[model samples]
Target: MTLHAIRDCIHAKKVWDLCVPKRWRKHFFLTQDVKEWVRKNITIKGRLEDFEWRQWFPIICHNIWLAHNDRVFQGSLPSHQDTLVQSRACLAWSSLVLHVSNTVAMPCWEPPDEGKVKFNVDGSLDVTQNLRGCSGLARNHESMVLCGFLYRMPSGSILSTEIWSILWALKVAWDRGFRNLEIEGDCVVAVNVVIEGVGEEHPDLCVVQEAQMMLKQDWRVNLLV
Candidate 1:
């Protein structure tokens, strides 16, 4: 999963996970300009899983260039409103494709079965602050809180946090004999991996395998989000 891209310009933008400087924004360059810059700029690459959102990068850049050209040569025929309307349509389609190919649907929190317990788990890693924490709480169908705990985990990749949080929660539930369990987490990838079971070649194989072994108990477990 080698995902590579060259970031040039879109003006200084503060977006999720990035803070682009003012002088580095795009210059309304043509495809050739983009291509040339990509060739010259550093090649940024990452695993396909982690960098999946980048699949939309080229298309987004193309649209930006088209909008620039239309404003300069077409006399802004498709005004800002028109541009936004078209963009929304394109975005909806792209989002669907992205979801189907490599993503999972986000889930909303809900209660478990009548006799079962719902375990809500979450992990956070503040890279800038070097803080990492994981927490889990159990609730019953009647909206009664049962047990919960918060623990500090080592700072690492998002996968680490996701795996650790759920893994810890599972252990707690198992020890307490909370057999019929519904586990929920915001990390869909981690949720799916735990639900479907992990493979030998996976990066977090050891921890995931341990979690899988734990899931084989006499309890019925379900994972979401």
Candidate 2:
């Protein structure tokens, strides 16, 4: 039983016991079929409060396989303590790389689900020229442009332009009876302010509040940053 030797053996079992949460251990170790077990553990969603099972699954399996190889070929293998340290190091490095890739990558545009429209908006500012504006378009699931708006502001912060764009887009959509919308913008601050609400002392409080109020109307709006 290669799977048993790699996973259920004394040394490997000790490592898994320390790494996997007790509450999830039953479901984690339930499957005995090799393919099903591998698929189940690797693709399992959600995580422990402080741990990530998705990353841990492969790391633990690789370490155990390495130890099994060492015992068979070299007649020597590191103690469970050494194996645990190596697994931790690998886990930390893997998590760091995952974080960096997620942060640096720009995801491709995905069409909205059926029966919904996606509104993509962006704001631009030229501080040197004292110019700012915002533009947005609504697209159907087929990527057909349904409606759009463009506005130029003589003077205002970039955040103001972004918030204004959202407000106007929502108003137009609501007027046209567009109830299901997924709004996207590159300005993280503006999106967060509208979705999470802003403080009274915030500079763009009024406009952000207006946008928030529109979102709370009898409509379904999703804000994506």
lDDT of each: 0.59, 0.75
lDDT of 1 by residue, 143-178 (tens): 555555556666567777788778887887897679
Where does candidate 2 have its weakest 10-residue lDDT segment? 88-97
Instruction: Score every model by TM-score.
Output: 0.50, 0.51
Q: In candidate 1, which residue ranges exceed 4 Å CA deviation?
A: 1-109, 197-203
Winner by lDDT: 2
Candidate 1 backbone overlaps, count: 4
Model 1 is weakest, by summed lDDT over 10 consecutive residues, at 11-20
Residue 152 lDDT in candidate 1: 68
Cα displacement (angstroms), candidate 1, residue 124, comes to 0.5
Among residues 3 or more apart in sequence or in different chains, the pairs in candidate 1 whose N, CA or C atoms overlap within 3 Å are 9-25, 9-26, 10-26, 11-25
Evaluated against the true structure, the overall lDDT of model 2 is 0.75
Over all chains combined, what TM-score does candidate 2 have? 0.51
